[model samples]
Target chain A: TQLLEQSPQFLSIQEGENLTVYCNSSSVFSSLQWYRQEPGEGPVLLVTVVTGGEVKKLKRLTFQFGDARKDSSLHITAAQTGDTGLYLCAGPNNAGNMLTFGGGTRLMVKP
Target chain B: NAGVTQTPKFRVLKTGQSMTLLCAQDMNHEYMYWYRQDPGMGLRLIHYSVGEGTTAKGEVPDGYNVSRLKKQNFLLGLESAAPSQTSVYFCATGSIRRQPQHFGDGTRLSIL
Candidate 1:
């Protein structure tokens, strides 16, 4: 099984602070996806990175895929209260029909 | 658009009880998935279906079963509830294998 491991499982920061979460895997994947899940709701896809070393920005959030396609990272600039949520990284398995998700990094941006 | 909808937002059952979670989508997606989320465990796939009348086991399929009799609906069933099975359940749908999936709000089940 291909597993995605996330670092800093819990994060608490003040508004305006910057934070970055990392996701790593021993096996390479064809593509990787980032998701943010708020309380009481299912996860919402933030972005999908298909190319190695590719970076995509969504407002204040920036996501980067590893050069070897075995890791990824999510960076939030000037975090806000609304940015507080569980961030997860996932990638398709060998079958490519399903995804394996990371444990997730829970972020809390206090006002 | 009601991308994906899961019935029974919250449910509590005693041991050995049986129940089914219903997932319905209107986006004409061909692939549907069932996942369980636990604290610090991320979302684990329980079952999935590529199309109607076809279901496949996922990473963790023990104690659960799924059926997709219709293209837009997928059902997950628990034959005998166990305390270990208590978790938030989410249903998702996708048009293709590589596309981003659409997920429902989730159903919280508590097995007492």
Candidate 2:
């Protein structure tokens, strides 16, 4: 089975700090997705990167897909208390029908 | 829009109890999925349905069963609850494969 691994499983930072979370995989995927889940709620999709080396920005968040399509990263600029949540990266499985998610990076931005 | 709705936001059951988690969608999505989230395991797919009357096993489907009798509703059943099965359950729906899916708030189940 394909797997996505995330680094820095737990992160604690002050507001205005910048942080980046990495998601790596050994197998290549057709596309990758980023999600942020807050406490007591399901994950909400942040972005989807379909092309290798592609980058997408959402307000204070930026996401990038690796050149080989085997990895992805999420960068937060000037993190705020509201930005604190669990960030997850996922990609389609071998069957291209379902998604395989990374363990996730739990971020806490204190004001 | 009430995109996806999961009933029983929180539930606690003893061993050998039987229960069903209901997922209803109003977006006319063709694909629906059930996943369980643990502390550090991410979200593991338990089961999925492509359309009405069709269901398939996912990565971890050993202790659960699912059925999709209607296009907009999916049901997950646990025949005999086990302590290991305690986790936060989420239901999601997508219009097509390989695209972003819409998710519900999630149902937290604790098996004692």
Q: Number of the top candidate by lDDT? A: 1
In terms of docking quality, how is candidate 2 classified? medium
Interface RMSD values, listed in order for every candidate:
1.9, 1.8
The parts of candidate 2 lying over 4 Å away from their true place are B98-100
TM-score of chain B of each: 0.96, 0.96
Q: Provide TM-scores for the models.
A: 0.97, 0.97
Residue A38 in candidate 2 has what lDDT? Answer: 95
Deviation in Å, model 2, residue A53 alpha carbon: 0.5
- Alpha-carbon lDDT, every model: 0.93, 0.93
lDDT of 2 by residue, B14-112 (tens): 999999999999999999999999999999999988889999998899989999999989999999999999999999998877454899999999999
Question: Tens-digit lDDT track for model 1 on A1-111?
Answer: 899999989999999999999999999999999999999988998899999999999999999999999999999999999999999999999987689999999999999
lDDT of 2 at A59: 96
DockQ of 1: 0.68
Enumerate clash totals for all models, in the order shown: 0, 0
